[model samples]
Structure formats: structure tokens, C-alpha cells
Target: MLTRPISEGNLLTEHNVHQNYRPDVDGLRAIAILGVLGYHAFPGEVPGGFLGVDVFFVISGYLISTIIFRSLEQKKFSFAEFYAHRIRRIFPALILVLIVSLLIARNVMLPNEFAVFGRHAAAGAGFVENFVLWRESSYFDVATTLKPLMHLWSLAIEEQFYLVFPIISWLAWRTRLKWPLLVAAIGLISFLVYVFSSPISAFFSPLSRAWELMLGAACACLAPKILAPKSAGRSFYGSSFSILGLFLIGLSFFGSLTTSLFARPVLINVMATLGTALLILSGPAASLNRLLLSTRPFVFVGLISYPLYLWHWPIFSFWTIIEGKSIDLTSRVLAVSLSLALAWLTFQFVEYPIRTNKRAKFRLATGLAGFMALAVALGLTAGHWGRHYDANIQKIIDAWDFAGYPEPPGAFHDPKYNFVSWRANTENEILLIGDSHAEQYINAIVASLNSSADRPSPQLMFYSVMSRFGIPQDLLNKIANDQAITRVVVSYFWSIKYGSPKIDYEIRCCGTGLFQTVGTKGGSSPSENEMRSLDAELEQLLTALRRDGREVDVILDNPFGSDLAPRSLVRRNILSGIQINAGVALSRAEAIERTEPYRSRVREIATRVGARVIDPMDSLCNDTGCPAITSDGFPVLKDYDHLSLSTLIHHVGYLNFLR
Candidate 1:
């Protein structure tokens, strides 16, 4: 599951002293790999199938610990030999995948995307992929399917564990410490960290994830004592335990569990880990183990599971990148089929020869190491010089880097309240408050002020936080007491703030970034309660500002869709080698239908509170559709929704209200 094959002598062996292969364990590997494939390809049907990774952790931990414990007992454990074997097993398929991915990325990806991919590739080769992904694990980060090397995080964690756990095993054996006790102690500490840490940390941190692997290691330590020629009732107990384990694993895979690991309950992972341990403990003679797992088909899949895991995600991801959206069901199935074929070929031709060639083991290890180093260098070079091979594509990608508008020279930073203010020599100031949507208007506001030098500009104070639902009491008091602040503007991604879909809260620095956990496509209609809450909040805030005779304006959210993204405008068919220029537009009718509920509610609240309403749709949309790219070839929206920097400079007249 970590993309390392379980070779016959080391992992598949079950006896304490002998090297007898266990085909049932290979069958278990087959299950884990298939679940992962299902989760990646058809997530809706197998919502919890991602839990297969946790199962893999247990399998890897158990097998690796078995090898270490057996080797230590035999007094033949050499770290050099152990690491060399690991290199031989891990590098063959991984090297091929990384090189192929880089080549494909160079030809197809945009400059910024290629830069990101290059960084991921370097991290993958250096075994630091987990750390890189952990840093970038944010709600605002790009979608998972768009990241080709995202799956490498698990492999990196496994490698890190292999590096540390062996030394711990040796130290414990050297000091005469009980292996089970040591594993339990370390696993307990890791479980505590996993439970208490931030979601992103819990998901990606090797420290937090160690307990799952240790669970497998614990099984290895205890199995011999627990199963040493036990009574006749042992068979009955094994069958029951194995059935229970299968049930738990099945529930995890098919149940209506949340797909977002960050938001999913910890019980899901616990169930999967416990289930995997149960199945492994059930042994080869158990009814399900012998009848189901040891079958020829399952064993074959398990044999190639390492390569299958390595090959599947990139194939799916590259298809998504080329299509500029989620691939169709047919495409996903085809991708899986292709991944299976490639995985088999890689296993037979690449992995088997390198792993089994006894005479050339040293040469193969050294050569693999050198190739890995080369991969690191090429990845770094690609990141540094993100020059696309195609000139026309490179020119189109150059337009993606839209620079931000600079803050005014006389801006004041309020550390206590965490807001920025642009002070002008004027009698009154305009306060802009909300989330990032409010922040996006700063560029247009500055441009408007600069264009109107004939008149005095109002002092500008911007509070870019989630103030739409609940304004900070301190900031509200500041606005109330400060008479110089004569006008207020409110803006937010209204649908996200009041959308009916289940909210998955994510910590975004000082405030939470609200994300709808419905699906990747779109969201459901706003609930009545959400609409009413928004109305009440807006009315309360507007009335408070109006009580002091200050003007208030509510700017509606901009029209947005995946089709309106710049990347979606340019697409490539990798197979056909054809480039297609897809038009970037969202239907005007659809935009209105999406926003009308919140728009009408905000309008009613503002009218009642004596505040004005500003609609961006008037400037952004036409009779036909809302276009993302301007007529002159400039991108209007930076991503999906937010106005681009170019839009701020070129279309400042839309914010005449600010002037």
C-alpha cells in the first residue's frame, strides 16, 4: 500500500523462524488496493474506500516488523542490506512513475501548475512529500484531483517510519525491553496526538499516523504467543473474529461516511485499522482467509498491488488536468483499466527483474539510487525554469500571473483589531468589512480613488474577515465610536455563507474559511433558516451603522462557475494531440438562479435598514452569459469568482459608489 512490494522471504513469510509464504496476506493487500482504486475512481459508490490507506498502514507495519523481529532473532539483521532491499523494491515503479509524470506534465500543464508539480516531484523523490503536502493542506488550496503527485504523501510517511522504527526495534532488543510494551507505548502517544492535533496535522503528520502502523507491529509481536498450538476452540474464535473484521471494513467502505478525511470522524480510521489487524490475526486457516483471500485472482492482484497503487492516481489526475474538470464515468473506468495494464507491465518487466536478480542486486540498488537523485535534480530544475515546451501555450500561461494592487503609502495597521486602514486628509472615512470577497474590492477602490484626483478621497478602512455572520464586538464598537467613519460597505460570498449544504469548517489563519461539503460540482439551494439568519445579521449591522447617519451598501457576490476559470478556457486532448480553445462563459440565467435567493433577501434587509444595494452582475453579465475573459483577451476573474487584478485596474468604473 505504501508502494513497496512484499517480497517472498521477508513479508509473505509467516513462521517465527522459517520463511514460509502466506498467500492470505497477499489477498488482504488485494482488498486494500481495490478499495483505494474504487475510492479514487468511483468515489460516490465507495465513499469510505479511502480508508484503504489505513488498512495498508497496518499491513505494512505488521510485515515490516515481522522482518525486523525475525532478522534480529537470527542475528543477521544488517541495516545496509535492509535499506538496499527497500531501495530495490520501492524505486523501480516509483522511478518510472515520476519520470513519466514529469514528461507528461512538461507537455500539458500550465506554468504555475508545472511549478507546483515539480515541487511535488522533488518532494516525492526525496521522501519529504508528506511535509510539502502538509504545508499546502488548506481549504483554499487547489483540488486534490488536480495534484498529480498528491498520493505520494502516504509513501513518504511509510518510508519515514521504516527509517525510524527499525532503529527503535534494534535499540529495544539491545536493551532487553519487551517489544509489545514499547510498541504500545509509542502507539498510545501517537494516537493521542492524532486525536488532539489539528485536522491537517492529524491527516498528514507522520508522528500522528505512527500509531496505525504500530497497531500492525503490535500484532506481529503478540501473534506467536496468541496462536502457538492453541485449543480446538481457537478455530471457532478465528472465524468469528475474521467475520467481524470483514464486517467493520465493509461498513467503512460502503457506509454513508464523509469523504473529506479532515472532517470525517476518527472512528472510521480506527475501525479500518482494527479490522485489518483482526483479519491478519485470523491467519491462513480461517474460513474467509482460505476461501476468499487466498484465491488465485486475489493473490495475483496482491502481487501487483504495489505497482497498481503507484500507477492509478496519476492516471486519473492527468485525465482531469487535460479535461479541465472532473472526468466522466467512462473516462474514469478507462483510466483505471489503463492503470491496471501499466501496473502489470511495470511489475513483470521492471520490478520482478530488479528484485529477483541476485547477482546484480548491488548494481541495481546503486543505479536506482543514482536515478532517484537525477529525478530530484530534474524536478528542481523544472520548478526553477517553468518554461513550457510549447510557445503558444507558454504565452497563454503568462497571462495567469495577475499582480495584486499595492497598498497605499499612508496605510495604518491596527494590530489589536487586525485591520488595515488607508488614511487620507478627509473629514469622513469608508469602512469595508466582510471576508475575502470584501478584500477583493480594495484594488477597484484604490483605482477609483486614483482616477478621481479632482475630489477628496474618503479614508479607507478594510476588515477582511468573516464578519457577514457575526461581526467582531471590538470592531463593531470601533465603528460605532469612531465618528470619522461615515460610510460602510459589506461584501461576502453570500451563497457559501448561507448555503444549505453541510458546512465543513476549516481554520484559515485568524478566521474560518467556510466550505460546502456537498460535492465537487455544485451546491444545493439555501435553507430558510440560513436565509433568515443572513437577513437578521445584515439588518442588525446595517441598522447600527444607519443609527449614526452613516451610509451603508451591500455588494452582492460575483457570478462564478468552474467553466469561468482561465484554465478551463484552454484544454488539450493528450491522446489525439489536439488543442481546443473552449469559450469561458457562465449562463446568465444560471447565475441569476443561483444568486436570486440571497440577492432578494439582502435587498429586503438593506431596504428596511435604509441601506443601499450594489449588484456586480450589472457590469459582469450580459443578455447571453457572464464571460470570464474580456473581449480584449484579458481574464476578468482571477480564479472562479474573485475579480482579477486586471479587472480591478481596467474596470474601476463599476465601483463608482466607492468614489
Candidate 2:
């Protein structure tokens, strides 16, 4: 039987190693796990449910510290045993989850996607999921929704803490000093640095997250010394305090606190630390501990929390992938039931036996290592198999002669113009400027112009399309000098240009002083500003390009509401008399209507600046409407309002203006 007042430790309350463990501590885990689940299941229902992770950090600190302090105080600290227990507890379930997920994923994922899954699995096994995720989270990629192992980042943080904290606690015990104070200070500093970086970086960085874990460690160090009956503040109002703390936690979940609100990420770290401390510290108070967290239901959920957390996200993610859409109400309910059932089974069959039995733990670890190695090998082989298939597919595409030739150098040949493929004759020099939309057409225009042997090879150069106007400050300085021999073509996505009524132009303007500073430093000719201020910069660029022995051609932006669905599917649906959603079909149709107003704006600006506006609205829209998909079964848009590569190639003739 476990004894009471197990040992006299610095932080351990008078209770010995054999003393009864607090059931309410598990109840707090119950609260944390449930809050997180509720948030993921129905985001709007509990927006702050993410705070549950904070609560977990605090509880972990309390319990783990209690155990460590007692062992150290009794001069029985065993690093080997501690680590063994940790490995047994954490890795078995995690490896099992990853293996199962990889097996399921291989059946349906694309070869490239499967390769990605394998990589994540390997990374998770290596305990660096957070680093993998941090590197990948950017606007250029679909970062968040894709990774099934994304949630493993928190566990990784905890594991890291577990590794470092034991060593630190051991050192502090040997020194008989307040070494935890030094640790807390370091954690605070690291958290500050994390908050200073990008939000995603702060979210993933181990250094940044260390404070939350350290907060728990500190509480563990302090709890015993402070809670002793002889201590000055040892008056027991445990039940009331626990109730108040739980209420605060609940209140926190209902509030609108978000990562976005924190000016510094460290602020959130601090808040989580404080909140967790209060909750954990109040847990063992008999009056509160008995009534609140001791409830059987709360304790039961806490027991199964680890398995439930592990299983939920993957099931949800896979369901979304297989359904090719989000889950509706019934599906969500079913998903929940399935998740719960799996959690219960895993707990009963796997976690419980391994945890309670020493020999069973050893067997379980051996079996898991074998299974994981087999799964990884199989996953790798599948990837190899898929790559071979893809290479063959590429060969077929080459055989079909779908792969095109490369274009030559000059303005049109510049890599900047490669995406757009703008073609030019020997008689004309073209300048393409604007955002990505304008830059995208350079290659087509250049290729189309080059295709004609009769036409003089025209030169083309594309400026930064994302620049606020045709002229960024860097280019503005250059254009004032370097009188390049002649014709100027300005092609930009004018609809999304700076000074548009919808977008704030000031915010859009970047790199304005770069060109001017370059000019002042004798880097190039002094750039003449036709429009002295940002508002008139576009018109100024047009006039300046003309003044310096150049003619200007401004390509108008394309239709704005293109969908990603294949054009062939859309046309086939129409022919088959199948009804599609009115919202999707009409959005494109409405986009076509907006062209006239956009055209008028372009014409008004072009007329004033003596530039010609090349509008492709007529080519894109038919009498009935603007088609989302092409007749050949290609998606017109890659995303909400931009054309896909195939869509751009099909409309290569739209570059006639460049010729």
C-alpha cells in the first residue's frame, strides 16, 4: 500500500509518497481535454477552447514536480527509471497512431501527397513536428489544414520539457539553491523573443514555448515548501479556491481572447502560466478537491484524454479529405461517436495494460518498435512505387509533345516576363508592370510574338508587378536616365491596382523610395515623376515611359470571379440539364458584368495618360455568361480570382496586344 507523508522534500507538501493521489488533478485534465475537443468539433461554439492546452501545461508541472521532488528529497532520484517511464508512456500510443494513419492515407492520397505524409511521419517519430510545421506555414502553401500530425507539436513541447526539467530539478536539489528562479527568468526571456518574431514562429518555437512548461516546473518546486502546515499562508480554503479557479478557467474559454490579441506572444505565455498555476495549486485542497474535480465523470474523461486527443484530429482530417468537403451535423455526430469508441478501445486494450504492468510495458515497447519500423519501411516502399509511376506519366506527357520550348533573351526573354510570355517585335520594346496577374502573361506574349518569323523581334522587360504603380521608387530613379531605345508597354492587373476604391493604396505601396534613392546615389538617371505623389504614380509612369521615346500599352485586368472547378464539368452539367449551385454560377456571371465599370475606369485613366488599355473581357465572356471552366475540362482559376497555368496557356492569344 502507498504510504502517507512519503518524504520531506523542498516543495512536496507533508504528504508522503504513499499518500493518496488527488483525483481532482485528473479532473482538471478532463476539463482541458474536453475544452480542446469542443473547440475543434464546433469552432464557433467555444472559440477559446484552445486555452485548454494552457491548463494542461500547468497540471503537468504540478504532478510531475510533485513526483520528482519527493524522489529527490528521499535521495532516490533515478534518471534511468524516469526516462524509461516517460518513453513507455508517450511513444507507444503516438507511434501506433502514426502507423495507422499512414496505412489509411496510402490508399487514397496522390503520390506527391503520400510522400509528404511519409515525411511528416518520419519527422513526428523523430520528435520535430513543430520545426517541420513552422517551416511550412506560409501563404505560398496550404499549410494548416493539410497536416494530420500538426497537433503533435504540443506533445513535442511537453516531451522536451520532460527531458530538461528533470536535469534542472536534480541540479537545483544538489545545489540547495533557488535554481528554478533562474530557469523562470530564462524562460521569460525566451518567450519574449518568440513573441517578437512572426506569429507562426512564436507558435512553433521551442524556446518561445518553454516558459509555459517552466511555469509548471516552478509551481512544482514551490508547492511543497509553501503548502506545509507550518507555513505562514497554509490556511486551508482549498475548496473555495479550487471552485474560483475552475470558474475563471471556464470564463476564459467563453471570452474572446485569441492569439491575434496578444501584442507579444509572451503575454499569452504569461497568462497561461498564471492561470494554470492557480488551478493546479488549488487542486489538493480537501474541501474543494473532494466536491469538484472528484466527480466520477470528470475523472473518467481525464483518464482517456490522451488517447482521445491523439485519435480525434486524424479522423476529422481524413473524413474531410474522403468527403472532399466539410462535415455536416450528422456526420460530425458520427465522427464524434467513432472517435470516442476508438479512444475507449485504445485505452482499454493498449494504454491500461502497458501502464499497469511492467512486463507488459516492455512487451508493448518491443512490439511497437517492430511495428513502427515495418510501417515506415512499407511507407517508404510505397513512395518509391508511386515515384516510378509518376516518372512514367511524365514520359507520356513528353511523348504527347505537350511540353513546350524555351524563349530567348531581351525584354520578352527576361525571367520576369517568362510566366506571362509577352511577345514583342524588333520594332517594339515592351514594359510589363503590376502585380502577379500582369507578370503571369509575359511568357505567352513573348512566345506569340516570337512565333512569327516575319515580325521583328521585340524586347520585353517586366518590372515588379506587386509594386504600387508601374514605378517603384527604385525603378523610378532608373527610368529618369538610361534612355533605352524605345517602345514602352505597361501591362498590369489594373483592377487590383493601388488607388482602387476598395483597397487602401497607402498600405499597398511598398518600395517607393528605393528607386528614388538609387537615382540620387548616381545609380541611374534621375527618374522623372509625372505624378509626384503615390496617387498619380500610375499615370506618371505612363507619361514618363512615353516621354523617353516610348509608346505605352496597358493590359487591363481579367475577369475577377473565376472558379477552380473544371470548365468541362461545368459545360457537361449544363448539357446534362443538371442544376449547379446558383451562388457559384452567378458569381462568375456577375464578374462579367463588373467588367464594363472597370473598363470605363481604365479608359478614363488611359485617355488622360495617352496609353492604350488592352481588355480581354470580350474574349473571356460569352453572351450567356463568363465560363468558370473551359470546354477542354480545365479549371479556369487556380484559386478564388486567379487563372491557373492551363487556363493561362489556353488563352495565350490574349497577348495579341504585346505583338
Candidate 3:
């Protein structure tokens, strides 16, 4: 299996078609896969488990570079053969996973969810999943949970790199330049970008992630020269460096290491990459490496790591969807056990057979083509289904959406105001100041104004809100200067804005700056101390507004129903052509129960500041339930959290606050 416990400094360990397969490398893959599996299935157990991907990059680079360099050096490298090998190695298991995923989603997921899945499936097939996800959100963003094909992004990145790297290697060989040096140079440039580029682009872009791969390639390219068994450098190459490497890997796995990037970044990745390279270079000669990593169990896992990675995430994601929340530990363990079984079976029955059968390569190619067709057809069918769902959603939207009039040239109608402030007589305009949370209720406010026959046409002045400020400096500045605005209504999505994944805001007082708040998302609510501080911040804003002689009304956040979009719920009900209350997505009682903390906090702060607290939860919802769809079968919300303009427009009399 392994180069049987090679003598110290005698295991330069070259691998080719004729060479013994390194079971130790497979063992290292085991470590990486475990890290990934642990992290995904139980992040609390393995927060740094993602570093396994870094380990994989290094292993992949070294293995690939070793093959390419050895072939090129011997003048036996072929592009056709290389790509054919790639197709064989990659597609069989992947196609199986895709087929199964599509089938499951078609039966279980709503039209919106399935539509998203279908789009990602096509992107995954094209090896553009990373780009598609990058365009959507950060890798670690909450949006990742819904996309069953999310992990395919890495495969896409690796495949995209494979397309370009061979040509680069070939050119270096042709030019008689040192391949290692060329790769190192390219890697250095990429590393710089990794460290300094915008976190999002750096994290997702192939151009930035290339360095991690290059590091492995560099290791392989220089293996013969630097990793050669040295007669004298026993401690340097044997146990000492290998131990340090393992330590680094452990540190990364435990997330004990200080380095981090956007909760997912480059420096932490470097630790795993470097550690994997060192351990790989140590070969099977190092006693510790041989004892632990070259074992059968570890090697078996390594063999199935690729397929396991593919199957695990989707299983967890779908389980979450089914459970209507995150999977519990028992479920996670069950999912992992099932994933391992599927992966092993897939590896044995699917991957090993097709990968080993050299003569049946043409058959492999034909099967791949057929699978591609199936994937395309699945994607097309999903999209076509989605279009019908969208058309229904659109008809509902048209009937309920309030903004029908076009804006006059040169005076923009801010959607928040629903009408241009300057175009309308603004001498007695109501000032609205808040983020998208406030913006969510624009239609409700407009509909109330439209029905008030006795009141002067209610002109509104809108100032965009930032979550970082309860009362923005811009709003304060506008109020200090403008006489047209007398009243200020504050609204925001308290749950989301105050929730984790927040940005740090720097408040400028002098030449220097201090961070006022950092919205690092950890959970739904803040700590008691943080809440007190937040309460104080609201009071400060209200007091300042009152001092400026402006009437301030703080509208309480609406009840958070099922966060799934209304169309999604509609699809769930209508997908089966059966309207069931059990499938309504959210009940008013549940919404009210959840809104307690928000309403209590808002009322507490409003009372302290002597400001009017507007609670819309009662107006929009009742004791029975908050229906997403209206009596006429038109949906109300754009999604679960935000109120649809049409819903507010049609149901305006609910606003007793306007009285």
C-alpha cells in the first residue's frame, strides 16, 4: 500500500502510472475531509473545519503538479489525455449526485426553491458555480443554506484552474524556464491579492485563490530537488518539521489560530496549505506520519472524500428545509452517517469502476454527454416551471402594488416617499427616516394617506436610514437646516439590522475615529448589556430629535412570520393544487409570540423618551393568524418579513395610528 516505512531521507517518493500509490496522501485527505465534514455538520464542534479545503488545495496541487511535471520532463505529456483523465476522475460521481439532487428537489422543494436549485445545477455543470455564488453573496452568508449545490463552487474553481494551469505548465516547459519558479512567481502575485484584495472577491475569485493551488504545484515542481532524501538533514526534514506541520493543521482545525478572513479568509487558509505541504513532503518516512496517516481507515476515507464532500452538504440542506430549521445534533450525525454510506457506495460502484476502466473511456465520455443532457433538461424544466410561478406572482403584485404613476423628469420619486417631496407642497411634510425596515411599510403609509379625505394631501420627506444610527447625522443635519419637515418617523428591521453579521461603523469626532457599533451576527438577539446600550442609543436619538422640536414616532417592527417568500408559500400550497391551513407557512399566534421581545423593547424605549410608539403588529395581524395570501387569493408580502405594497394599499383602514 505505502512505500513500506522508508528509511529516513530515502523517500523522495515519486508517483507515476507504474509507481506504488501513496496511501499516506490518501490518509491526509482523510484528515481534510473529516475537518470539512465536522465543520459543515457541526460547526460548533469544528469551527475551523473549513480549513480542510485549504489542505485539499495543497494536496491537489502537489499531486497534479507532480503528474504534469513528471510527464512534461519525460516529453510524454498530452493535453487530450490530461482532459480525458480529468473527465473520468470528476464526472461519474458528480453526475450521480446531480441526478439525485434534482430528483429530490423536484418532489420536495417549492417552485422558487427548485428554480434556484435548477439555476445552480446548470451553473455547477458549466463549472461556473463559484461565479454564480459570488454574484449572490459571500460563501459563509446565510443564503448558502438554501442552495443544495453550494459546495460545487469549489469543484468549479478547481476545474476552472485545471483548464488554464496545463497550458501554463506546457509553456514553461517549452520555454525551458524552471516550472517551480514560474509557478512560485504566479503564486506570489496571487498571494498578494489574497492578502490585500477586497475580502469577497479574494475569497471567491479564481484569480485570488490560484495562489493556494500554486503553493501545492510549487511543492510538486520542486519535489525532486528540495524534497529529495537528504543523508544529513534528519531533524529538519524528518520528524521536527512534520510535527510543526501537524500542529499548524491542528490549530487551523480547532480555530485556535489567530488568523481569520471575513469569518472565511486567506491567512487562515495559509496555515492549512503550509501544513498540508509540509506533511505531504515528509512522505511515509516520518514515523508519526506513517503510524497515524497511513492507516487503512484514514486512507479509505480519503478515497471517498470527493464524493463525500459533494453528498454531505445537500443532505444537510434538504434536511434543514424539511425540518423547517437547522438540523439537530442527532439529525446531523444521522445525515453524516448516511453521507458516508452513500459516498462509499458511490466510490465503489460508480467512481472506481469508470475511473479504472481504461478501455471503456469512450463509454464514460458518452455517459457524461448523456448526463449533461439530463442536467440541462432538468434545469430547463425547472426554469420553465419557475416562469409560470413568477407569472402568477406578478399578477398578484400588479393588483396590489401601489406605485402606478410615472415620475416627472428632473425630480426623482424616492420609493420610500412613494411621491417626490419637492413636487408635492412640502411646507408641512412628514419626515420619514429609517432603513429598509422603514421602507418596508411605505405602501401602508401611502394607503393611509390616500384614504384620509379630510386631511390635506399628506406630503412626505424621506431621508434614507442606516442601521448603524438610530438617528443619522444626515437626518440631524437636514432637520437643523429644513423648516419643511416637522415630524420624524423612525422604522427599521430591528431583528435583522441588530442581528449578527454587522459591519463596524467609525464615528468621527476629531482627527481620529472610534467604532460605535459592530454588527457581528452571532444569534437573533443581543446580550442584555448590548440591549441596554442599544436602548440608550435609541433614547439619545429621540432626545436629540425632541430638542430639535420634531415630533418623533418610532414604529415597532412587524411580526416576523416564516422568512420564506410569499410566492414560495404560494407555490408550496399551489404546487399540489391544494390550499391547506397547515401549509399556510405562518400563523398570527406564532407571529405575535415571536414579536414580544421586539415590542417590549420598543415600548420601553419609546416611553422613556416620551416619543409615540406605533405598533403595526396589531394592525396588520390578528389573534387568529397573519395570512400571507389575501381573501381573493392574491399574496400580500414580497417575502415573509416585508409587507407588500398592495397588501398595505388595499388594507389601509387598519392604520389607526393615522387617526
Every candidate's lDDT: 0.77, 0.59, 0.67
- Which tens-of-lDDT digit does each residue in 345-366 have in candidate 1? 9988898878877777668889
Per-model TM-score versus the true fold: 0.84, 0.76, 0.78
Best by lDDT: 1
Per-residue lDDT tens digits of candidate 3, residues 299-354? 77888898999999999877765554557899999999999999989988887777
Runs in model 2 deviating more than 4 A are 1-20, 171-198, 225-236, 257-268, 286-288, 322-337, 372-382, 385-427, 470-487, 498-551, 560-562, 565-588, 594-600, 607-611, 620-634
True-structure RMSD, every candidate = 5.0, 9.0, 7.3
Displacement of the residue 528 alpha carbon in candidate 1, Å: 5.4
Q: Which scores better on TM-score, 2 or 3?
A: 3
| Model 1: ten consecutive residues of lowest lDDT | 507-516
Backbone clashes in candidate 3 total 6
lDDT minimum window of 10 residues, candidate 2? 511-520
